[model samples]
Target: MFINVSDESITVNNKWERAELAQIEEISMYPVALIGDVLQRLGMMASVIRHVAGKATFFGTVLPILTWEGDNLAIHRALDDAQPGDVLVINGNGEINRALFGDLLGEVCLARKVAAVVIDGAVRDIQELDAMGLPTYARAVNPAGPSKYGPGQVGFPVACGHIVCNPGDAIFGDRDGIIVIDRRLVSSLAAKLKLQDDVENNFRARVRASLG
Candidate 1:
């Protein structure tokens, strides 16, 4: 059954499902930056969406969130609706003062094995996130916590770094940057990317031979 997070029950839909997104693990092997490069730089999030804490490599289908500045109710709502292989992609409306995510929520993501989190605003607890080895990319860090107010949406398109992200979009992030791909294009694009890699490798080999 499909779990729904109604306007009243994002708090209760917080049940974690057994892993069903195993294919994303295989897709994660593709270099996110290279894929974006090959695609002529489309789907890359804003450069400001950067490494704040945790391991660098991560990729997953997105569960996008939209929240008002200085508020994080949508993020909490998305948490209940997120799957194990889903990256919580947040558009915090560029609010930089109040940190919307932190260690406690990271504990939940860790226990549930959520792939990663990318917030286009702010997050705190950098050291704790690093210690847990979870990949977290955010615009900045702040000590002030946010209000849990409403007027937010979950599982919708939200602009992170000027890039509009829809639910179930493929996303990859590393120290280099974050790249988002349309979910429907993942299969065909991945195949083409593999071919490009082979061609590049052989070209490099020929160059080496000529030099030798």
Candidate 2:
């Protein structure tokens, strides 16, 4: 059940089911690194995609957008379909020369109640973004703004940070980096994540006792 809009330039798929809110909330309690461990270290985005501004933690269903390098028309269209808990996962072809997001878009996202933003490219307006408190991550920062031309895709699968991101996939990020979890795997990973957290907590406690 996907809506496809095709033209000479841009394409969009407007339909995908989000993970249950309860499931998303439950997974949010675990650390992103621990979740990656439970996924056998296969779901993490590349370390190059670091936290660039705002809060360091965010988790929500992905809304993937693919845009031409140095262009951002598709990003604007994607927002039209955005839901309250979406994380805009943009694949800007890893182009660091031009920023694909900034403070004005951040304001729109906040108004829309978007959870966060992850870009495999660049972003600008760091001070404004940080003040706005929208969790944002990117490969770099550039003062160069993006062109608004088309030839992009929205609500489709995109390769970002060397990992494939699909709309409706659960994405989590913190200081460590970003990780994607398939919607189907969300429920199954909860117990494993909890157990690993407990183990790590106990190990840290033992190290503290030795020091004492």
What does each candidate score in C-alpha RMSD?
4.5, 3.6
Judged by whole-model lDDT over C-alpha atoms, candidate 1 comes out at: 0.79
What lDDT tens digits, residue by residue, belong to model 1 across residues 1-212? Answer: 11233445222223222222454555567687668767889999888989988999998888888887877777766766667778888888889999989998898788777889899899999999999888999999998998776568787677998898878878888778998877777766757777777887899999999999
Model 1 scores a TM of 0.87
Candidate 2 lDDT, 1-212, residue by residue in tens:
11233334778888788877688889988888788888899889999999989999998999999999998878887887899999999999899999999998898899889999999999999999999999999999999998876789998899989999988999988888889988989878788888899999999999999999
> Which regions of candidate 2 deviate over 4 angstroms?
1-8, 210-212
TM-score per candidate, chains pooled: 0.87, 0.92
Look at candidate 1 and give me any clashing residue pairs: none
CA deviation > 4 Å runs, candidate 1 = 1-23
In candidate 1, residue 105 scores what lDDT?
A: 85
Return the lDDT, model 2, position 51.
91
